[model samples]
Target: MNLFRLSKGFITEVHRLFALFWWESSDVEKRLHWGSWDKLCESKNDGGLGFCDLSLFNQAMLAKHCWRFIKWPNSLVVRVIKGRYFPTSDFLHATKCSSDSFVWKSFMWGRELIEAGSRWQIGNRSSTLIYEDRWIPRRHSFKVQSPRVLGRDAKVRLLLNTSAKEVEAILSIPTGSNLDDYLLWHFEKDGNYSLKSGYKLG
Candidate 1:
């Protein structure tokens, strides 16, 4: 279904199945509803059953596709999408072409989740623009608004070492021959997205 965004009607129909089980009813008959479905969807702390709202869960699941595309560019699906829609750039900066497919648009809708959890892991720094990309942990971008900011054209590649073995951003600009930087997800050790993590993000 992720080939396109699921329609509201489809989601509601799926929810109908859940509602049948929820109220201890069947498709053929009604049963007593102990509480509103919205209340059942609320967190336990909110005095409800903590079921994830299905609509939001659906979106989060779809957003997982976006997360996967960002972190796993080596995958076949990523390769296809990259070639088709974003050959010139990485997923983070990819803009839609007029020829975007339904799935690409569906994936694009989930881009915000990718932005929320990703930070550039500085490597060659070629793709990252200094002060423009978020790299320095905790601060959004370099946080340097001063007109006195150093070397306006600087890139993340400046943070590499002469040995090209380690980062050297402390006393001088890092310089390296590496050709690309990468996205790192803040929540996972492997930087992989899972349904559980996506739920947390939701």
Candidate 2:
């Protein structure tokens, strides 16, 4: 299967191959399908053949690519994409360009899946934004972004004072000079990705 699905058009070669294999009779003539292709793409428990939907599978795979990009931002592939589409904004906050490459557009399509399943795993608060990133377990930082509540330069480090005390903060994780903030999959512990989770999301 192509890594990028329908990046330019409606269907991919994999789908075309599937149609040929499933609907064509011996050598030449096409056979009448016993059931609708959509129905056949459902789960066996749902009274269908349990065939995998190529489109959904493709989306799931693309989403994993986005996840990998975010998980390892310094990778060559991510560096290229980020350099072009999101020089100022991070992956989750990046806006779609009017004239994006087909692959870049495809990358945009799968980004939401990664965003929905991921959260910041705070090792230290350095990279996290006090008002922007989701360092808190239940939700992202402060619900409101009022100037009166927090100054413009506010950061995750602001939660702790010089005394190393919690200054109106709920988090109490220990900080170190070498610690760095990282991402984790909210659905599971030990931070692993699963195709079942991705397909279920689709």
Candidate 3:
């Protein structure tokens, strides 16, 4: 006397369950159709019947992490999992499976696809160099190229400011020179200029 018993078996049971939740005839029909499970889960805008199976949706959501791991294997979450459970290898073998659940395998497959298309860039704001879509050790050190000062006055100011003592030492060279040049040279060499005294470059 299980009251829910029907000649159509599981399909009838599913339909009955849908009925209790206020689904219309069209919804029941869509759920009953033996189409691709993925298509059935999609939104109606994508041309699929909008029937969400929550358990499947949860699995799919968690499956995204698999892709994240493959994209950034050295990321914090992946690192923790690698340290705690996968210490011995980069790739997890089927036999050594810790979880061994079907959902976990599905996630791993998604990760594999992400890993195949991964690429990297190395450089600063001014320029960048691209690297292959594989896990290779980074061998080169990157540094920002010193920007060149453009205007003549700006260049003089830059030279004056950077390594001021060195510039003053160079200007102090006793080779015969013009009065203006000689006076300017002495001003810097004596380290008596107001700007030099006021600013502590370091």
List, residue by residue over 58-81, the lDDT tens digit for candidate 1. Answer: 666777888778767899989987
Ranking by TM-score: 1, 2, 3
lDDT (C-alpha, whole model) for all candidates: 0.66, 0.66, 0.37
For candidate 2, lDDT tens digit of each residue in 58-86? Answer: 77788888888777889998898889999
Estimate candidate 3's alpha-carbon lDDT, on a 0 to 1 scale.
Answer: 0.37
Clashing pairs in 2: none
| Model 3 regions lying over 4 Å from their true place | 1-19, 24-48, 91-202
For all predicted structures, in order, the TM-scores are 0.64, 0.60, 0.31
Task: Kindly provide the TM-score of model 3 when superposed on the true structure, using C-alpha atoms.
Answer: 0.31
Candidate 1 global lDDT: 0.66
lDDT of 3 by residue, 1-202 (tens): 1111123365446645654454334633543335554466566777877665443333334434544444467888788766754577653332235565554455554433233322122112111121211212211211112243333223121332323333443343333323222111112334222222111110
Q: What is the Cα root-mean-square deviation between model 3 and the actual structure?
A: 24.2
Which RMSD values do the candidates have, in order? 6.7, 7.0, 24.2
- Give candidate 2's whole-model lDDT: 0.66
